[model samples]
Target: MGEVDIFKIMKEAEKRKKIKEKPILVKKVEIKEILPCLTTPGYIRFTAQADREIADVIPIIFLMFPPGKTNYSVKENTLTLRAFNRMITFFPNGKIAVTNTRDKQEAEEILQKIIDIINEAYRSYLKYGKPSKETIEAAAKLSWMDIYNSLPKTNCGECGYQTCSAFAVSLLQGETKLSKCKPLKGEYFKNLERLKQKIGEIMLNTLGWE
Candidate 1:
Protein backbone atom coordinates (compact mmCIF):
# COMPACT_ATOMS: atom_id res chain seq x y z
CA MET A 1 0.00 0.00 0.00
CA GLY A 2 1.15 3.53 -0.66
CA GLU A 3 2.16 5.61 2.33
CA VAL A 4 -0.73 7.37 4.00
CA ASP A 5 -1.02 11.01 3.02
CA ILE A 6 -0.76 12.41 6.53
CA PHE A 7 -0.03 15.94 5.30
CA LYS A 8 -3.12 15.98 3.14
CA ILE A 9 -5.21 14.57 5.98
CA MET A 10 -3.97 17.23 8.37
CA LYS A 11 -4.71 19.99 5.84
CA GLU A 12 -8.23 18.63 5.38
CA ALA A 13 -8.71 18.53 9.13
CA GLU A 14 -7.55 22.12 9.44
CA LYS A 15 -9.96 23.16 6.69
CA ARG A 16 -12.78 21.49 8.57
CA LYS A 17 -11.79 23.27 11.76
CA LYS A 18 -11.88 26.61 9.96
CA ILE A 19 -15.33 25.76 8.60
CA LYS A 20 -16.56 24.92 12.09
CA GLU A 21 -15.20 28.10 13.66
CA LYS A 22 -17.72 30.89 14.02
CA PRO A 23 -17.10 34.03 12.00
CA ILE A 24 -16.49 37.25 13.90
CA LEU A 25 -19.50 39.49 13.60
CA VAL A 26 -18.31 43.08 13.57
CA LYS A 27 -21.43 45.02 14.45
CA LYS A 28 -22.58 48.07 12.50
CA VAL A 29 -19.42 48.07 10.47
CA GLU A 30 -19.41 49.67 7.04
CA ILE A 31 -16.76 50.27 4.49
CA LYS A 32 -16.28 54.00 4.62
CA GLU A 33 -13.76 54.43 1.84
CA ILE A 34 -12.02 52.62 -0.99
CA LEU A 35 -9.13 54.13 -2.93
CA PRO A 36 -6.23 52.98 -5.02
CA CYS A 37 -3.05 52.23 -3.12
CA LEU A 38 -0.39 54.81 -3.88
CA THR A 39 2.47 52.36 -3.69
CA THR A 40 0.94 49.57 -5.69
CA PRO A 41 -1.57 49.94 -8.46
CA GLY A 42 -4.59 47.59 -8.26
CA TYR A 43 -4.18 47.28 -4.50
CA ILE A 44 -6.64 49.29 -2.38
CA ARG A 45 -7.00 51.56 0.59
CA PHE A 46 -9.99 50.41 2.64
CA THR A 47 -11.47 52.21 5.61
CA ALA A 48 -14.32 51.10 7.84
CA GLN A 49 -16.40 52.47 10.66
CA ALA A 50 -17.73 50.44 13.58
CA ASP A 51 -20.45 51.22 16.09
CA ARG A 52 -18.40 50.64 19.25
CA GLU A 53 -16.03 53.18 20.73
CA ILE A 54 -12.49 51.82 20.41
CA ALA A 55 -10.58 54.84 21.68
CA ASP A 56 -9.89 53.16 24.98
CA VAL A 57 -8.23 50.29 23.18
CA ILE A 58 -5.70 52.40 21.29
CA PRO A 59 -3.37 52.57 24.27
CA ILE A 60 -3.66 48.85 24.72
CA ILE A 61 -2.68 48.34 21.10
CA PHE A 62 0.34 50.53 21.66
CA LEU A 63 1.20 48.66 24.81
CA MET A 64 1.06 45.33 23.01
CA PHE A 65 3.45 46.24 20.23
CA PRO A 66 7.21 46.41 20.60
CA PRO A 67 8.36 50.01 20.35
CA GLY A 68 9.90 50.17 16.90
CA LYS A 69 7.44 47.79 15.27
CA THR A 70 4.50 50.17 15.47
CA ASN A 71 3.82 53.88 15.48
CA TYR A 72 1.65 55.03 18.36
CA SER A 73 0.85 58.51 19.53
CA VAL A 74 -0.50 58.59 23.05
CA LYS A 75 -1.51 62.20 22.72
CA GLU A 76 -3.45 61.44 19.56
CA ASN A 77 -4.73 58.06 20.74
CA THR A 78 -3.83 56.37 17.50
CA LEU A 79 -1.92 53.20 16.73
CA THR A 80 -0.56 52.30 13.33
CA LEU A 81 0.41 48.73 12.55
CA ARG A 82 1.39 46.71 9.54
CA ALA A 83 -0.05 43.26 9.06
CA PHE A 84 0.91 41.29 5.98
CA ASN A 85 0.21 43.54 3.01
CA ARG A 86 -2.19 45.77 4.94
CA MET A 87 -1.36 48.95 6.80
CA ILE A 88 -3.88 49.40 9.65
CA THR A 89 -4.48 52.57 11.57
CA PHE A 90 -6.81 52.66 14.55
CA PHE A 91 -8.64 55.90 15.27
CA PRO A 92 -10.12 57.05 18.53
CA ASN A 93 -13.57 57.47 17.02
CA GLY A 94 -14.26 53.78 16.28
CA LYS A 95 -13.12 54.22 12.72
CA ILE A 96 -10.31 52.12 11.26
CA ALA A 97 -8.17 52.73 8.19
CA VAL A 98 -6.60 49.96 6.17
CA THR A 99 -4.35 50.17 3.13
CA ASN A 100 -3.07 47.72 0.50
CA THR A 101 -5.98 45.32 0.82
CA ARG A 102 -6.83 43.49 -2.40
CA ASP A 103 -10.58 43.16 -2.01
CA LYS A 104 -13.60 43.50 0.28
CA GLN A 105 -13.18 40.01 1.73
CA GLU A 106 -9.55 40.72 2.58
CA ALA A 107 -10.51 44.04 4.16
CA GLU A 108 -13.16 42.30 6.28
CA GLU A 109 -10.70 39.62 7.32
CA ILE A 110 -8.18 42.28 8.35
CA LEU A 111 -10.84 44.11 10.36
CA GLN A 112 -11.68 40.94 12.23
CA LYS A 113 -8.00 40.34 12.83
CA ILE A 114 -7.53 43.89 14.15
CA ILE A 115 -10.46 43.41 16.52
CA ASP A 116 -8.98 40.21 17.87
CA ILE A 117 -5.60 41.87 18.33
CA ILE A 118 -7.11 44.85 20.10
CA ASN A 119 -8.98 42.58 22.48
CA GLU A 120 -5.83 40.64 23.20
CA ALA A 121 -3.90 43.87 23.70
CA TYR A 122 -6.47 45.07 26.22
CA ARG A 123 -6.19 41.86 28.19
CA SER A 124 -2.41 42.05 28.20
CA TYR A 125 -2.44 45.68 29.27
CA LEU A 126 -4.65 44.79 32.19
CA LYS A 127 -2.01 42.36 33.34
CA TYR A 128 1.35 43.78 32.16
CA GLY A 129 1.07 47.54 31.74
CA LYS A 130 3.02 47.87 28.50
CA PRO A 131 5.46 45.78 26.54
CA SER A 132 9.06 46.82 26.98
CA LYS A 133 10.67 48.75 24.16
CA GLU A 134 13.12 46.57 22.30
CA THR A 135 16.19 47.59 20.34
CA ILE A 136 15.48 45.21 17.49
CA GLU A 137 14.43 47.68 14.85
CA ALA A 138 11.62 47.01 12.38
CA ALA A 139 9.82 49.03 9.77
CA ALA A 140 6.36 50.24 10.75
CA LYS A 141 5.50 50.63 7.09
CA LEU A 142 7.19 50.04 3.73
CA SER A 143 7.41 52.53 0.90
CA TRP A 144 7.62 51.83 -2.82
CA MET A 145 10.20 54.59 -3.21
CA ASP A 146 12.50 52.75 -0.88
CA ILE A 147 12.26 49.64 -3.00
CA TYR A 148 12.51 51.57 -6.24
CA ASN A 149 15.57 53.42 -5.13
CA SER A 150 17.31 50.19 -4.21
CA LEU A 151 16.42 48.45 -7.48
CA PRO A 152 18.79 48.29 -10.46
CA LYS A 153 16.55 50.70 -12.41
CA THR A 154 17.63 49.16 -15.66
CA ASN A 155 13.97 48.92 -16.74
CA CYS A 156 14.85 45.57 -18.20
CA GLY A 157 11.96 43.20 -18.78
CA GLU A 158 13.84 40.31 -17.20
CA CYS A 159 11.61 40.51 -14.14
CA GLY A 160 8.54 40.69 -16.39
CA TYR A 161 7.87 44.26 -15.28
CA GLN A 162 7.83 47.12 -17.73
CA THR A 163 9.54 49.58 -15.41
CA CYS A 164 11.73 49.42 -12.34
CA SER A 165 9.05 51.20 -10.36
CA ALA A 166 6.57 48.50 -11.37
CA PHE A 167 9.01 45.87 -10.15
CA ALA A 168 9.41 47.76 -6.90
CA VAL A 169 5.65 47.77 -6.36
CA SER A 170 5.56 44.07 -7.10
CA LEU A 171 8.32 43.55 -4.57
CA LEU A 172 6.30 45.38 -1.93
CA GLN A 173 3.35 43.11 -2.79
CA GLY A 174 5.47 39.94 -2.57
CA GLU A 175 4.86 39.31 -6.25
CA THR A 176 8.52 39.29 -7.30
CA LYS A 177 12.06 39.06 -5.93
CA LEU A 178 15.29 41.01 -6.32
CA SER A 179 17.06 38.00 -7.69
CA LYS A 180 14.71 38.04 -10.64
CA CYS A 181 16.10 41.35 -11.88
CA LYS A 182 18.76 40.33 -14.39
CA PRO A 183 20.42 43.73 -14.42
CA LEU A 184 20.87 43.83 -10.65
CA LYS A 185 24.56 43.16 -9.95
CA GLY A 186 27.43 44.32 -7.73
CA GLU A 187 26.38 47.35 -5.63
CA TYR A 188 22.83 47.25 -6.93
CA PHE A 189 22.59 43.60 -5.91
CA LYS A 190 23.81 44.46 -2.42
CA ASN A 191 21.12 47.10 -2.15
CA LEU A 192 18.52 44.51 -3.12
CA GLU A 193 19.80 42.21 -0.41
CA ARG A 194 19.49 44.97 2.15
CA LEU A 195 15.95 45.74 1.01
CA LYS A 196 15.08 42.08 1.23
CA GLN A 197 16.35 41.97 4.80
CA LYS A 198 14.35 45.04 5.71
CA ILE A 199 11.22 43.47 4.24
CA GLY A 200 11.81 40.24 6.16
CA GLU A 201 12.11 42.17 9.38
CA ILE A 202 8.88 44.04 8.68
CA MET A 203 7.06 40.80 7.89
CA LEU A 204 8.17 39.27 11.17
CA ASN A 205 7.16 42.35 13.15
CA THR A 206 3.74 42.25 11.49
CA LEU A 207 3.24 38.76 12.94
CA GLY A 208 3.73 40.28 16.44
CA TRP A 209 7.27 39.14 16.87
CA GLU A 210 9.23 41.05 19.46
Candidate 2:
Protein backbone atom coordinates (compact mmCIF):
# COMPACT_ATOMS: atom_id res chain seq x y z
CA MET A 1 0.00 0.00 0.00
CA GLY A 2 1.04 3.65 -0.43
CA GLU A 3 2.26 5.78 2.47
CA VAL A 4 -1.08 7.63 2.65
CA ASP A 5 -3.03 4.33 2.80
CA ILE A 6 -0.75 2.99 5.53
CA PHE A 7 -1.27 6.12 7.62
CA LYS A 8 -5.05 5.94 7.18
CA ILE A 9 -5.11 2.27 8.29
CA MET A 10 -3.11 3.11 11.42
CA LYS A 11 -5.57 5.88 12.33
CA GLU A 12 -8.55 3.56 11.91
CA ALA A 13 -7.00 0.91 14.14
CA GLU A 14 -6.40 3.51 16.88
CA LYS A 15 -10.02 4.68 16.65
CA ARG A 16 -11.36 1.14 17.06
CA LYS A 17 -9.26 0.54 20.16
CA LYS A 18 -10.50 3.79 21.72
CA ILE A 19 -14.14 2.88 21.05
CA LYS A 20 -13.78 -0.53 22.71
CA GLU A 21 -12.62 1.00 26.00
CA LYS A 22 -15.21 1.35 28.78
CA PRO A 23 -16.41 4.89 29.51
CA ILE A 24 -16.73 6.38 33.01
CA LEU A 25 -20.30 7.35 33.70
CA VAL A 26 -21.25 10.00 36.26
CA LYS A 27 -24.46 11.71 37.36
CA LYS A 28 -25.22 15.00 35.60
CA VAL A 29 -26.62 18.20 37.08
CA GLU A 30 -28.12 21.32 35.57
CA ILE A 31 -27.01 24.94 36.23
CA LYS A 32 -29.75 27.51 36.60
CA GLU A 33 -27.69 30.71 36.21
CA ILE A 34 -24.57 32.58 37.35
CA LEU A 35 -24.28 36.12 38.71
CA PRO A 36 -21.76 38.69 37.54
CA CYS A 37 -18.86 40.08 39.62
CA LEU A 38 -17.93 43.63 38.71
CA THR A 39 -14.85 44.10 40.89
CA THR A 40 -12.51 42.19 38.62
CA PRO A 41 -11.63 42.86 35.02
CA GLY A 42 -13.46 39.84 33.64
CA TYR A 43 -16.82 38.31 34.34
CA ILE A 44 -17.32 35.19 36.44
CA ARG A 45 -19.28 32.25 35.17
CA PHE A 46 -20.33 28.86 36.60
CA THR A 47 -21.46 25.57 35.18
CA ALA A 48 -23.28 22.53 36.53
CA GLN A 49 -22.03 19.21 35.25
CA ALA A 50 -20.79 15.76 36.23
CA ASP A 51 -17.50 16.33 38.05
CA ARG A 52 -15.19 14.07 39.95
CA GLU A 53 -15.82 13.63 43.70
CA ILE A 54 -13.63 15.65 46.06
CA ALA A 55 -11.88 12.51 47.24
CA ASP A 56 -12.51 8.78 47.54
CA VAL A 57 -13.44 9.37 51.20
CA ILE A 58 -15.33 12.63 51.02
CA PRO A 59 -18.88 12.70 49.64
CA ILE A 60 -18.61 16.38 48.70
CA ILE A 61 -19.01 17.24 45.00
CA PHE A 62 -17.84 20.41 43.27
CA LEU A 63 -19.04 22.99 40.79
CA MET A 64 -16.54 25.00 38.73
CA PHE A 65 -16.56 28.74 38.32
CA PRO A 66 -14.04 30.30 35.96
CA PRO A 67 -12.76 33.86 35.72
CA GLY A 68 -13.22 35.49 32.35
CA LYS A 69 -9.93 37.35 32.81
CA THR A 70 -7.12 35.17 31.50
CA ASN A 71 -4.34 37.15 33.12
CA TYR A 72 -5.78 36.84 36.64
CA SER A 73 -5.65 33.07 37.04
CA VAL A 74 -4.56 29.88 35.34
CA LYS A 75 -6.03 27.11 37.45
CA GLU A 76 -9.11 25.57 35.87
CA ASN A 77 -10.84 24.52 39.09
CA THR A 78 -10.41 27.67 41.20
CA LEU A 79 -11.51 31.04 39.83
CA THR A 80 -11.75 34.73 40.68
CA LEU A 81 -15.25 35.81 39.82
CA ARG A 82 -16.24 39.43 39.48
CA ALA A 83 -19.41 40.80 41.09
CA PHE A 84 -20.06 44.37 40.10
CA ASN A 85 -16.73 46.02 41.04
CA ARG A 86 -15.49 43.41 43.51
CA MET A 87 -13.80 40.07 42.87
CA ILE A 88 -13.98 37.04 45.14
CA THR A 89 -11.93 33.87 45.23
CA PHE A 90 -13.29 30.37 45.94
CA PHE A 91 -11.59 27.09 46.53
CA PRO A 92 -13.45 23.88 45.67
CA ASN A 93 -10.41 21.89 46.65
CA GLY A 94 -7.88 22.09 49.48
CA LYS A 95 -5.12 23.25 47.16
CA ILE A 96 -3.54 26.68 47.59
CA ALA A 97 -4.28 28.15 44.15
CA VAL A 98 -7.87 27.12 43.81
CA THR A 99 -10.44 29.72 44.82
CA ASN A 100 -14.00 30.69 43.87
CA THR A 101 -15.81 34.00 43.56
CA ARG A 102 -19.43 34.99 43.96
CA ASP A 103 -20.81 38.47 44.55
CA LYS A 104 -24.54 38.03 45.02
CA GLN A 105 -26.95 35.58 46.65
CA GLU A 106 -28.15 34.46 43.26
CA ALA A 107 -24.61 33.58 42.24
CA GLU A 108 -24.03 31.64 45.42
CA GLU A 109 -27.21 29.69 44.82
CA ILE A 110 -26.03 28.80 41.34
CA LEU A 111 -22.63 27.70 42.68
CA GLN A 112 -24.26 25.38 45.23
CA LYS A 113 -26.35 23.75 42.54
CA ILE A 114 -23.27 23.27 40.39
CA ILE A 115 -21.48 21.60 43.28
CA ASP A 116 -24.39 19.21 43.63
CA ILE A 117 -24.17 18.25 39.97
CA ILE A 118 -20.42 17.63 40.05
CA ASN A 119 -20.75 15.40 43.11
CA GLU A 120 -22.67 12.98 40.95
CA ALA A 121 -19.69 12.41 38.68
CA TYR A 122 -16.14 11.22 39.34
CA ARG A 123 -13.99 12.06 42.36
CA SER A 124 -12.61 15.61 42.44
CA TYR A 125 -9.11 16.82 43.18
CA LEU A 126 -8.05 20.04 44.87
CA LYS A 127 -7.09 22.90 42.58
CA TYR A 128 -4.15 25.30 42.95
CA GLY A 129 -3.67 28.97 42.18
CA LYS A 130 -1.22 30.59 39.74
CA PRO A 131 2.47 29.80 39.81
CA SER A 132 4.68 31.50 42.35
CA LYS A 133 6.90 34.45 41.49
CA GLU A 134 10.06 32.35 41.68
CA THR A 135 8.74 29.81 39.21
CA ILE A 136 7.82 32.55 36.74
CA GLU A 137 11.22 34.19 37.03
CA ALA A 138 12.95 30.91 36.33
CA ALA A 139 10.98 30.46 33.14
CA ALA A 140 11.91 33.97 31.97
CA LYS A 141 15.59 33.20 32.51
CA LEU A 142 15.52 30.76 29.57
CA SER A 143 16.11 33.77 27.31
CA TRP A 144 15.56 34.48 23.59
CA MET A 145 19.24 35.24 22.85
CA ASP A 146 20.03 31.77 21.49
CA ILE A 147 17.39 32.08 18.83
CA TYR A 148 18.51 35.60 18.16
CA ASN A 149 22.06 34.47 17.48
CA SER A 150 20.91 31.72 15.09
CA LEU A 151 19.41 34.20 12.69
CA PRO A 152 21.37 35.26 9.59
CA LYS A 153 23.72 38.12 10.41
CA THR A 154 23.95 39.28 6.81
CA ASN A 155 22.58 42.77 7.60
CA CYS A 156 21.40 42.81 3.98
CA GLY A 157 18.66 45.29 4.88
CA GLU A 158 16.11 43.23 2.94
CA CYS A 159 13.74 43.24 5.92
CA GLY A 160 13.74 47.03 6.01
CA TYR A 161 16.40 47.31 8.69
CA GLN A 162 20.06 48.25 8.96
CA THR A 163 21.52 45.28 10.86
CA CYS A 164 20.60 41.87 12.24
CA SER A 165 21.59 42.82 15.77
CA ALA A 166 19.34 45.84 15.58
CA PHE A 167 16.49 43.62 14.47
CA ALA A 168 17.19 41.15 17.27
CA VAL A 169 17.06 43.93 19.82
CA SER A 170 13.81 45.10 18.31
CA LEU A 171 12.37 41.57 18.46
CA LEU A 172 13.30 41.33 22.13
CA GLN A 173 11.51 44.63 22.71
CA GLY A 174 8.48 43.44 20.70
CA GLU A 175 9.21 46.04 18.05
CA THR A 176 10.49 43.95 15.12
CA LYS A 177 9.72 40.53 13.68
CA LEU A 178 11.78 37.36 13.97
CA SER A 179 11.08 36.81 10.29
CA LYS A 180 12.93 40.02 9.65
CA CYS A 181 16.12 38.01 10.03
CA LYS A 182 16.40 37.20 6.32
CA PRO A 183 18.73 34.24 6.92
CA LEU A 184 16.15 32.34 9.05
CA LYS A 185 14.39 30.55 6.19
CA GLY A 186 13.65 26.77 6.08
CA GLU A 187 14.17 24.67 9.25
CA TYR A 188 15.93 27.46 11.08
CA PHE A 189 12.89 29.65 10.52
CA LYS A 190 10.58 27.01 11.96
CA ASN A 191 12.85 26.54 14.97
CA LEU A 192 12.84 30.26 15.60
CA GLU A 193 9.04 30.24 15.39
CA ARG A 194 8.90 27.59 18.09
CA LEU A 195 11.30 29.63 20.19
CA LYS A 196 9.06 32.64 19.77
CA GLN A 197 6.05 30.74 21.08
CA LYS A 198 7.99 29.47 24.09
CA ILE A 199 9.32 32.92 24.89
CA GLY A 200 5.86 34.42 24.58
CA GLU A 201 4.38 31.83 26.97
CA ILE A 202 7.10 32.55 29.49
CA MET A 203 6.64 36.28 29.22
CA LEU A 204 2.89 36.03 29.60
CA ASN A 205 2.87 33.57 32.48
CA THR A 206 5.85 34.94 34.37
CA LEU A 207 6.61 38.51 33.44
CA GLY A 208 3.04 39.58 32.67
CA TRP A 209 2.47 41.17 29.28
CA GLU A 210 0.50 44.19 28.13
Backbone Cα, N, C clashes tallied per candidate? 0, 23
Best by TM-score: 1
Checking candidate 1 for backbone clashes, the offending pairs are none
lDDT of 2: 0.41
Model 2: how large is the Cα RMSD against the reference? Answer: 12.7
**Predicted candidate 2 versus true structure: per-residue lDDT over 160-185, tens digit per residue:** 77876666555544455555555566
How far residue 167's Cα lies from its native spot in candidate 2, in Å, is: 0.7
**Please, what are the lDDT tens digits per residue for candidate 1 over residues 85-181?**
5678888887888888888888877777777776665555455454322311223344567767877777878778899998777665545655677
Alpha-carbon lDDT, every model: 0.65, 0.41
What is the Cα-based TM-score of model 1? 0.48
